[model samples]
Target: MKSDMAQEEDEPSGAVLDQPQEISFRRALLDRISPLISSTYTLRPFPSKWQVIRHKLEQLRSYLAAAGDSPSDSQLMELLQSVTYTAAEAQALASRCADESYTGGKLLLRSNLDVVSAKLDFHLKRLEEFYAAGILTLARAIVVSRPPAGASREDMRFYVKDLVSRVKIGDSQLRLRALGALNEALLEDEKYARILSMEVANGVASLVTLLESESRDVQEEAARAVDSVARFDSHKAALVTAGAVAPLIRLLEKPGTSMEAKERAARALKKLTENSDNAWSVSAHGGVPTLLSICSEESGTSELVHAACGVLRSLSGVEEIKRYMVEKGAVVVFVKLAGAREEAAQVQGIELLLRVACDDEQSTAVREGVLRALVRVLDTGSPKAKEMALRAIENLCAASPSVAMLDHLVVSGFLDRALLLLRGGEVCVQEAVLKAVSRLGGMSEVVKKAMGDSGFIPELVRLLEVRSLQVREMAAETLAGMISVHKNRKRFVKEEENLNRLLRLLNPEEKSATKKFLVAALVILTDSTSVRRRIAASGYINHLEKLAETDVTDAKKVIKKLSSANRFRSLLTGIWNS
Candidate 1:
């Protein structure tokens, strides 16, 4: 009785103590509201917004943050419940979050609506767990093109700041997601595009910062993003303006940048210099030295060197840029790459040499170092390198910068390297080697001589049996090109052994491409009376008719040329009758 009297005396002045039953309900109610403040934890990182549900979430987050978590639990629960909607009702609330009308009589006392709604948001649908992932995808989609609602460019700017402040990319997938979103946004939205391409290049800047990410995936994404941004004309200027060159150069020094990234970076440099000022910025910023060093790496994959070479070649196309490349002694590295082992290395290095060789225009003198390199690549390089070298040698042979390089290529053992490629390597290498042989057929006096000397006609004909469509077509095309321009090369390759091999390519068992190549080879060899009759003796006419009817065929290279070749029609006549 004394304790009860003390509790009664402890009541607020002039207020009567309520009965225990009434006080118990009040306490229970407060217990429910205690969770209202705790519920705010769910709002962080901002779940992706669906078209309509985003507003409800926004409203919920706004209310929670607006209250500052300082209220009592019971009061909080009351406020939450006062929202006048079930969690389902709220989460399902359409994109029209601004509309607050309700149609229910089961509502709480008019004053208790918010409190009830806040409490209900906690028990949302099972699908809610994937809400963030969904919203992330939607954000990526919508960012490309802005939605027609509440979020504005200004709003996105603020949201971006908030996101950047909060999100820490933890893995490759997340990095991919972020990069994808930014790429879409850059592609679609004028505002975000401007922000990235002009205002600040925000996405590009963010990716650049992530260049240091320990995750290879993140670095890869970052590098790819840089390349993508470089594709946009608007962004290229921004990247250059934002001092992106040095950071990109610095990234190259990191052992982490993949060959793919190096290739892309080289491509980006090409786009970046589409504006001359950017090229000036690159050279002025020590980019020349970096390109030279990257090009000098003769031991690893040559793609890196080729990529670096492509960049220098593209950059130096401008007079000032050419002077920068020359002063940097890029030719020495170009020659070095010709002797490298990796196929891409040789191919790219020769390509770069062609770009800067100044052989096309009569203005500048040739760098013998560069010429020697092309000659070396032509003579000693792998199949791809030799193919590229042939193109470069063609250019060199046409002009001032080491016209002698061509002579060295033909007279030396260079022709043998190509033959080796055809004899043993993969079909693609063979195709490329065949094309190189065609391209240089007119240039290789000794190669023509060697064809006679080495009895190459039989070998050339045998290649018609190559399984790859591309290889067979290339072989046929090579024969036609060689015979069209060089009588010596033609005479040496169309003799007895060669004629029989070419005839078999039109055999019923061969691919349609083989038939097409046979047609081409037959046309080239038809100038000789005996070979012409021998081809007529071969029964291929019925097969050619059947092949012409196929819709899904890949012999487009041959079909288009058939009408133009003088002997193609007669060869068709022979095949049709036989």
Candidate 2:
């Protein structure tokens, strides 16, 4: 951090701080005025004003220590010179006031004292501004350098500290370079991110302030660094505490800001809002509308749209913000995003749609549009995308089971797509499909029968044998909904294996929570005499007897129904034998 002041003494006055000779001259001037202000001859005449001026001069002398080595801005050196000469003038005037042979009048002397005091006060304030801008600290800051390869933690710590300081006070080019290096260091490892965010003073704040830099390069680099730091969960709280949200939203809102900068800002915001408090911070800063606008812009790059929608998706977790997003036409944005060619954008949009679809019912066109996009996702998207799309469809139809919407779902082949997904999709996708089936199936008997006829019942029945208890429970729940339609009940009862599986699940030894829904499905079937006769004859009736004794959810009622059917069967057999 050595200063670069030159030895040349002949440079112009504008470049005086660069010349060691001028620094020495400024020092000598301060020294000569020091004794004049220190003496009682001056202080006794104007005690209060002299005290103030002397203190200001002392502060000015402190600046000389750094100014002697550092190449301060020209303005700073000029002010220093002005104050030093003013202090000398104040000393001469005080001397005139002190001496009885002085020719100047008393009022004139008092006025001179007032003028000098005002000048010192004004100079002190300007010096304070310089310090506040970190000019003095910048002067003393170590020279910026790249960290050595395989640097030790201590070495890295020093490097990161220097970078943060430079970012806080460096010139435009220096700040840009420092920010670029800082961004690289942060991304290279979380350790540097930790040091910058928690250990280095004002480190996060420095990055945040640069979000508003006049230089587009500086803004971009700062955003990159903030985005990197924000990716680590441990650093997010510090960023929010440092007020990163508002500037981030401003960057997104700023017109004609380069997409590169906006993308990084949006990404940092996405990470920040993962924490609920940070989401509220963004919402409080009016970030939701900004995010929605980004999502709505058709010309936005896929990555940009994906990142912006990602922010809104995170924000949707908050109930209050979720409603607010709905009011602001986030649904329209989400539906548009859901149709994007990019898989990531579609996933983000669908995820948010799943959260808020139930609250949005005014736009049937939007719902259908979202439904069509979801179907497209189911058809071509990756497994995760398919899962999110299924959930969104489930929520959309469940929220508003209008005949038209349900008809749209059916007419658009939602059931067919779901059936295919259930057959071959990943376990997660299948699970989401089961939920969708349960919701949509319960909405319409036509949908239920359509699902039953499409072999959904068979797939659900087979899912009962799968290992995930949740899947089995959802399967049973969906089947229970399907069987409420008389045709579905008959279709389910026609499979003796389905009945046997249900009977096997009823075993008290089976601890699956699916038993309740299985029991409910069986109760729906017991209305049929043949189905009851088949269940009574099954070997797994022992499980039913145990469940009946425990009165496990409609178990006794199932037994009573089976008992009545048994009596009828015996009478029929006896009559036939006679």
Candidate 2 residues 1-578, lDDT tens each? 43433323233544535456445666687577556645633345667666556545544543443332555556666676677678778768766756733566667777887888788778767865775665444443335465766877655765676676556545787677777777777777788998788766567998899899888888899889889988899889999899999999999999967899999999999898887778888899999899899888877788788788778878888888888888898877877777677778878878877677666534787677767878888887878788888877887787888899898888898888888888887889889998888878777888888887788888888889898888889888998889899988878777778888888877788678888888888888889878877776788777877998887768888888888877877899999999
- What residue pairs clash in candidate 2, if any at all? none
TM-score of structure candidate 2: 0.65
Provide the clashing-pair count of each candidate structure. 28, 0
Per-residue CA lDDT of candidate 1, range 1-578, in tens? 56853454455543423434323433443343234323432542222323123333433332222121111322223223443234434333321222333334224322233543434455222113223333112122112223444566545543333232112322345446656555555455556655555433144566667766676666666666677778778667667755677767766766777766666666667678767777777777677887888777644345556556666766776776776676677666766666777777666667767666753542333545565566566556766676677666556555542435555655655567667667776666566667666656555554555554544455566676656767767777666545544554356444566666655555555446556556654554555555545544556443434455553242332333433443776788899999
Please tell me which predicted candidate would have the highest TM-score against the true structure.
2
The local lDDT score (0 to 100) that residue 197 gets in candidate 1 is 51
Candidate 1, residue 146: the lDDT equals 30
